[model samples]
Target: MTPSETKEHSPMQQQAQTFGYRLLKQDGAARLGEVVTPRGIVRTPAFMPVGTVATVKALTFDQVKQAGADIVLANTYHLMLRPGAERVARLGGLHNFMRWDGPILTDSGGFQVMSLSKIRKINEEGVRFASHIDGSRHLLTPERAVEIQCLLGSDIQMQLDECISLPAERKETERAMELSLRWAARAQRAFSDLAKPGQALFGIVQGGVDAELRQRSAEALVAMDLPGYAVGGLAVGEGQELMLRTLDGVLPHLPSHKPRYLMGVGTPSDLIKSVARGVDMFDCVMPTRNGRHGLAFTWNGKVNLRNARHADDPAPLDEQSSCPGARDYSRAYLHHLVRSGEYLGAMLLSWVNTTFYQELMAAMRLAIAEGRFNTWAEETLDRIERTN
Candidate 1:
């Protein structure tokens, strides 16, 4: 039977009848937990690779699973625009369409739509924007955002919120945050109206960079008692320091029992530091995107495979990696493949990079469970910075 149709929850699912988090362990502000879903349980400190167009660029869903991702993220805006949400639902939802039965989280598409400001107009109702695919006009209401995610059969759905660029005046930030709060209420009402089983909806905290504004945004969303909470509006040209500071300012206000997600955030170091500050789930396209650009993220640090210095280097990116590209293929060969623009280069590097990220999350999970996350992070960061 389909997950939604299951009359009986599994033993593990019984522990969490609906979608939720069970805190397993904690060290400092870092936490280790399990996100119990109908499809499976996602370990805490999870990093969801962005499969923005229903695919993770070059890699297949099997490769994504092999790389250790318990859950993958999809874009609501993109899917709603192309192929259409109704079309996906008719084909048996995103899980059947993508052939991935595991848990899936979908974004509200607010960020992507906001990026098309030149072609979009914003008001109290929602954003009316032009589609990039064919320049067709569309109105993205908060109610419609929840509707799309529901049609996609997303296990974890993000509520529609306004995301603003950094360096904005306090007045602008307050305006956006207040608007997001309104959207959160409308989105929640719409989500509850459907009341789909075995799924959860999350509210986003957005306020640009102001401390008071962020705190206000967090407090408002917290009042809603969302199933999860996401810290948005960072990684939008805001430096790492400010981002972490914002997390520090905002996270304390969110409930610890629920999962805390940092949206569209960043590199290996960024993950390390954010976890240190109490964030649990994260999603980003850095690894796959950079892999396609001829870059590799290793435990030792990032490797620029396109550089000529590696033309004669016989060493692989990492001899210990399970991924053949990092464990078996030599730097010289990888360099040549990248230089020649071979498809294998992108595939191999994408797999290798994604594997490394999962490895990092696994390592952090272990450390947090063992009460050694602080020391582990310190040593790991030192190693990454010192390595090439």
Candidate 2:
């Protein structure tokens, strides 16, 4: 009958039962947990590096692992267009294709669909668009999205959702939210048709910035009884305070046993705040994107390698960092590489930024388990500010 009803006894959740999460500890609204996937187990409060198109930009799979990421995310849109999902599946699926043996999460190409608004049209069926890459036309339906992710063999797959841009009227937000619910049902049926036991399907909650709408979406998606849930549509220009507030509205309705993912979310500060608000997973492009522009994330804070003040600063970004790129390289040297537009600059900075993010997650996990997250977060934020 309904998506929620079918989800209870679906084949997807029946056999393997491998895709599961365990709550290890909790501190206030914050939680500590572990997600067991077919590939491996992802420790809770984890920050997954965005590996769009089957790779984290400027870094190899080994480097991704070295950066402390137990899992990474790939874009269904890009991979489907360039390499083709069928081709990837034929060549041993995403794990072997990307050469990353750990867990992988794939979106339903929904964000890219929204981003290509100029070239796309949405209907009850799906969205049709002209690819930004080669101007080729394509149609992405909920079933097709599920099929593509299934072909990619993602350990965790997101449902195809209609993500509305912010600053919209209540009616527009409601329309998009309702469409997403319908798509969720279609996605569930498609996912159930192909998903194995070890894999999972995650439904996204979308209602723009409207708190009431967010609650509605959360309740509807939660009714689906999916293995994981993601809070979507908030990071689209909503300020940090609103984002956290929106999370507060949705978190209560979500199943505590399931992992909560916040898509394309934010800066270091955003991650810390989201975790404090009970989010268990996050994926963002900030760390590497900022790194390529010569920004370095460190224990002390952010370092702008472009600043002339670092011309002769021989100090390492962080002497205590285990990453050689972050601990061994001098600031002056890094400044030179970045200033000169050298490829090495982007690579090294990406490595360093990734390392720092992982370190942040590790620190939070420890603090939450030890029951001092609030105190630790306050002191750490102050330290980062002072170091900056």
Candidate 3:
């Protein structure tokens, strides 16, 4: 029987019976929706923080939750390499291992095949690569990828797809896209055989920057009718214009009822633009990564705490902000902490930036629900571009 036909909920999935998406509202091409998992509900247009290795770097799980994240993403390739997927499963799954009860999404590690791995080769079966840490050899097939994600007990799991960098020849792009489609089918079969009732495996659309190839990939994946679809292989050196153009061409082919995720996507403006194109979910490391470098994202635009201009600026990042790191601490203090390379600077700024991203998602949801997303997006983008 398929996962959907399973008679009992898996012990790992608590009260969750199945995965679903509910489209609550829309404005133009913008959408407001909820991704329902057995674990919890994720409101869209949602921004999930990257918790690579089951941690969001400097921030604690409580800080992540308090920052308003409904989900966190983990890296499958890294985990399978290090602590190992079996080790995590033996430790009672990633949620138990990491102590985060909210829904978790695990990337199939296709991106790492392009990055991270110092040396690698691709074939019909999967990728064979050396571990970045210890130079150990490992093979990651689509079937093995699905099994690894299943072991983690993630609420949402991505299909293993080969991600290619931009500025490549049409033939090269087409070859990678077709390979990803074949892998998607393999992933689906494995998921059907191994996944629990409440878990979901999403197919990814990969076509580099070629619009026609993108549509071809989307059409084929949509035919599979997976739980969700993700637009992958972008945001890897292609500028904003081509990325948006590709989305404009390909998104309509995807089913409206299923959630649409744009993988490894971008900045505040990128999210706003992608939302306008009807994407439902996103995950990126920009907020926390930039925060660790003393950059804070606020409504007033980017604030670089390393600047001497803020050395005496007694004002908080945003006194009107809800997060203490943003509202309570002065810029002067944060600047001192950051310039001095204090760890608390990373912690507090990470919290502040994370909270800001969640706040942005909440704002987009409200705007989409109220039928004014276009206007709100225009105004918000303008405000965000002005800088600090």
- On lDDT, the candidate that comes out on top is 3
The full ranking of all candidates by lDDT, starting with the best, is: 3, 1, 2
List CA RMSD, all candidates: 5.4, 7.2, 6.4
Once superposed on the true structure, which residue ranges of model 2 sit more than 4 Å away at CA?
Answer: 1-17, 385-387
CA lDDT for candidate 1? 0.88
lDDT of 2 at 50: 93
Instruction: List candidate 3 stretches off by more than 4 Å.
Output: 1-15
TM-score-sorted candidate list, best first: 3, 1, 2
Evaluated with TM-score, which candidate comes out highest? 3
Candidate 3, run of 10 with poorest lDDT: 1-10
Better of 1 and 2 by TM-score: 1
Task: Summarize candidate 2's per-residue lDDT along 45-86 as a digit string, tens digits.
Answer: 889999998889888878878767788999999899989999
Q: If both were scored by lDDT, which would come out higher, candidate 1 or candidate 3?
A: 3
